[model samples]
Target: MKAVVFSRYGGPEVLEVRDVPEPKLGPESVLVDVRTVSVNPVDWQIAAGHLDSRFDVRFPVIPGWDVAGVVAEIGPTVTEFAVGDEVIGYVREDSIGRGTYAERVAAPLRTVARKPMNLGWEQAAAMPIAGLTAYQSLVRTLRVGPGDTVLIQAAAGGVGSFAVQIAVAMGARVIGSASDRNHDYLRQIGAEPVAYGPGLNECVRALTPQGVTAILDMYGGQTLTSSLDLLSDESKGRVVSLTNDGILEQGGTFVFARPSKADLDQLTRMAESGVLTPEISTVMDVTDAAEAFRLSQTGHVRGKIVLRVMGRLSAAIH
Candidate 1:
């Protein structure tokens, strides 16, 4: 199989397309004939060794987690999906490498869900990690609901876009912070748009004087710290950060997205019902994954970036 691999930690320049052996399927996993893969910040962060302290890395790592494709083969113990089932997955493993940046990936059943029929392959691939993160943080952690005012940082990006739509669907009034270029986009996604920067708190307060009922922070450091005071007294502990662990010390929750088939299924339902739609900003061939990583590293993309796997395999008979 052909896959993108990086032998050492560095930048996107270190990535290369190469011929690698097929992934070994586990007893509870299915081998997917990958059609599309999406780029997440964590993918490049892993490649650049930013997550060295968290995950064990092996050399010649294939960096990707989000996949949308057809099942070519199912494991002996896997009964939830059979050959030819269309699926999407957040294919993260305990160790780094053996990822979805290839023609095929062995996806565990716990992380896999049927793809939303309403979404194309690229759109489906864009949903897993970002959608799950948003769903878990807003629905599971903050418990946002009707009458609540929710503030989402980086609301035009992958996770933030999902967060905005999900919160809105849950009856929360959402306020999203992004650049001027993305303000209109935020509005389209059912969020009241606010320009993020030096006066972000002031801008949010101007919309709701009492402060928001919940905050979802995708950008750490100053963006996370500065928004602490923007929460209502009753909602002071309703802040969740995807980027900052220090949020734990600040009486806020720090979320690391976990793969849950049930959560992915709920997102799929939302997509099929027209309540959730992934916004894809760019699509590149898997062979040009290096450029895709570079684009993700810029931190300015409005939505998800996807890599189309050329020459996808036909679903094989078991």
Candidate 2:
């Protein structure tokens, strides 16, 4: 199998293409011919060794979490899936051992979900991590509901786009923060967009004089701190973050995305029904994965950046 792997962590330069052994299938695993995979901030963060203390990944790791493909072979114990089933899901962190920047990956049964038949591979690949984070952030951690006011930071980002749409579909009044360039785009997606620049907190205050009912902070640093101050005293106002999990004592929930087959399955169904959609910025070949990782780390991506795996999978969604 051809893959992009690196023995060390540093920069995009460290990622290299190589011919590697195919992953050995487990009794409960399915061998997928990966047609598409997307890059996330976690990919670059893990690659740069920023998560070494937490994830504890060994050297020579292949970095990717979101995968979409056809099941080429099913394990003996697998019953829900069969050969030629189209699937998509967030691979468990433990399976980061083999990685997804390759032609094939053997994914555990619990982590995989049926892909939406109507959606293309690029969109399916982009949905897992980003979509799950958005779903869990609003529906699980924050409990967003009708008439609620939600302020989503980085509203034009990978997770942020999903958060905005899901909050709107739930009947919540959504306020999104992003740079001026994305303001119009955010508004088109059912969010009341706010310019995220100097005095961003003041801008948000001006938008909602009653104070926001909830906040989904996908960006850490000052963005998280700003959200902590913008919450109303009522318990209805809570802050949920995917990038930060520290210093929240003011009745706000701190959150991190955990992969779940049930959540992925629900999200895929939503995508197929057109209740939710994955926004894809660009799609590139796996051999150009370094470029995809570079684009993801910029923090300015309007949506997900996907990598189209080759050879083992068919030619699609390039």
Candidate 3:
């Protein structure tokens, strides 16, 4: 199998494309013939060694988590899927040694589900990590509900795009922050776009004068702190950050959306039905995966970046 592997954590230049032995499938795993894999900030973060504490990577790591592929073989214990069944999911960060930046990967059954029938391989690959995180943060952690007003930072980005759509589908009035260029796209996806700038707090307040019921801060540093101050009552507003800045404040909640098979299944359904759609900024060859990592680190991507692993599946939903 040809894979993008890095012997050590440093920069994108450290990544190299090489022929590596195929992964060994476990009793509870399925071998996926990878078609596409999306790039997330976590991918680059791990490659740059920023998440060393959270995940200890074995040397020569393949750096991708989101995978969309067909089951080439099934584990002895796996009964949910069979060979040729299309699936998508995020790989365990600790299991980067068997990562998705390759022609094929063996992933635990618990982390994967059948790919949405309405999504292409690229779109399916884009959903797992980012979409699940947004869904969990809003629906599970923040408890956003109908008649609620929710603000999502970086709305044009990967997680933000899904958050906006999912929140709207849940009947919450959503306000999203992005640059001027993304505002139109965000609006089309059912979010009231707010151009983030000098006084983004006031901008949010102006849009939802009654005050936001919840805020999911994908941009943590200043965006989150400002969101905290915009709350009319702390109880009505729940702020959740993907960052570990400790800014949830007294009587508030901070969440790191943990991966869950159940959550991925829900996201997959929402995507297939068109209630949620993933925005992909670019697609690169597997060999150019290192460049994809660099793009993700810039933090300016309007949507998800994906690595092309193989030909699109004819049966894949598009």
Name every residue pair that clashes in candidate 2: none
Each prediction's Cα lDDT score? 0.92, 0.83, 0.82
lDDT of 3 by residue, 1-318 (tens): 677788888888998877788889999999999999999887778788887876656878887888999999989998989999999987774444667887788888888988999998878899998988888888998778897888888889998998999899999989999999998999899999888878888888788777888888876676676677776574444777877547646455666556678899999889878798889899887777767777888888988998788843221212
Summarize candidate 1's per-residue lDDT along 1-318 as a digit string, tens digits. Answer: 788889999999998777788889999999999999999999999988999999899889998999999999999999999999999999999999898988899999999999999899999999999999999999998888999999999999999999999999999999999999998888888999999888888899899999999999988998788888988888888899999899999888999999999999999999999999999999988877889988998999988999888473221101
Model 2, 176-289: lDDT tens digits are 999899988898889998888678888889988878888888767876776667777784437886766663654556766787889998897788778788888998888787
Clashes of 2: 0
Clashing residue pairs for model 1? none
Report the number of the highest-lDDT candidate. 1
Residue 232's lDDT within candidate 1 is 86
Candidate numbers sorted by lDDT from highest down: 1, 2, 3
Instruction: Supply every candidate's count of residue pairs whose N, Cα or C atoms clash at under 3 angstroms.
Output: 0, 0, 1
Q: Per-candidate RMSD vs. true structure?
A: 3.0, 2.7, 3.8
Clashing pairs in 3: 119-317
1 against 3, candidate with superior TM-score: 1
Candidate 1 whole-model C-alpha lDDT, 0 to 1: 0.92
TM-scores, all models, native as reference: 0.97, 0.94, 0.93
